[model samples]
Target: MGQKVNPIGFRLGVNRDWRSRWYASPQEMPGFLHSDIEIRDYVKKKLLFAAVSKIVIERAWNSIRVTIFTARPGIVIGRKGAEIEKMTEEISKMAQGKQIKIDIQEIKTPELDAQLVAENVALQIERRIAYRRAMKK
Candidate 1:
């Protein structure tokens, strides 16, 4: 018989030697792959969210509100707004010939709104005697 070779061993050696050293271990390989995929997915999702958020907030508020809050608007607006536009477009695409309405409020400060809303909600939830019933009360 000809020289016998372990196919799995050869394959493993090829995988270990031919690939980049950045992924050093077998355990690290999956992590590296997942991270790469995750980053791409995150970027896409971020763009979508930004687009939808911008459209919603813009539709909900008038030019005056936009002008007043322009400085802090960037946070809600997101990077390049490409993602935001992508998100809005995706929604519209899903609706298929019908326009989707998005409503977003433009607070003086978004960061502050979150803090205030959270605090208020917590207070309502925590301090309210009837809890659920008193939440709206």
Candidate 2:
């Protein structure tokens, strides 16, 4: 038998870091945590077709910063960054008046990312491609 460890948990503070960077006061902790999950879910659902690889959320006094890592940055960015602007507005509403900053980061090698790779394979299969052929390539 082998021990199992979560990749994200194992890598935290090493190659990866905490999502919520700042500490919240006890009175504000619940609201902050709730807003974090709400923002994450809303963004993920809105960008479902954007080949999102990972989402990083950080908090500061009076503001939230969301950095989205995606295999297809252009989709999330849209023409003239319109998509991001709209997303920011939506997230601001979800945050209940906190300022929100959205940043998009591109993943150069989608194949190396497990989520991107799986999504790619699933998309190919949906388009009638053979799973074996897709995986073998």
Candidate 3:
């Protein structure tokens, strides 16, 4: 059998860090892990059109900090910051009433990001554009 390893795992601590950051005891590990997965899924689905590339979730004492890295920051930060407030409220509910803080980081070179590039092509294809046409862009 061929050996396989996740690229991210291989580079962790070298040039990459885990998306979720927290420490938990054995008794609390399962719940915490599940919550992290749910939170990540919710954020991705909520910002489907915002070109979100990555989400970093950090827990400090009683608060949760969600850092969203996206190509389009304006969409994530809506008019007058109302979108952010709404998202915080929703995520707070998921966090069981814990404080939710959201921070947006713009990707300076989104065109050079592999994940974003792939997502762009997939979206174009989903819109009924030819695969060759999607790749050209």
- What TM-score goes with each of the models? 0.27, 0.82, 0.93
Q: Across residues 1-137, which tens digit of lDDT does each residue of candidate 1 receive?
A: 89988865578666533211232368655844554344334433553322211211111111101111121345444587553455456544443423433323455554344344454456567765566664453
lDDT of the structure predicted as candidate 1: 0.40
Q: Which stretches of candidate 2 lie over 4 Å from their true place?
A: 1-7, 126-128
- Please give, for residues 1-137, the per-residue lDDT of candidate 2 as tens digits: 99999998999989987876779879999988888888888888999999898888888878988999998899999999999999999998888778888988999988899888888888889999998998875
Q: Rate the local accuracy (lDDT) of all candidates.
A: 0.40, 0.88, 0.93
Q: Cα lDDT for residue 112, model 2? A: 92
Q: Look at candidate 1 and give me any clashing residue pairs.
A: 47-83, 50-84, 51-84, 51-85, 56-104
Ranking by lDDT: 3, 2, 1
lDDT of 3 by residue, 23-133 (tens): 988998898889989999998998999999999989988999999999999999999999999999999999999998999999999999888999999999999999998
Best by TM-score: 3
How big is the positional error of residue 116 in model 2, measured in Å on the Cα after superposition?
Answer: 0.6
**Which candidate wins on lDDT?**
3
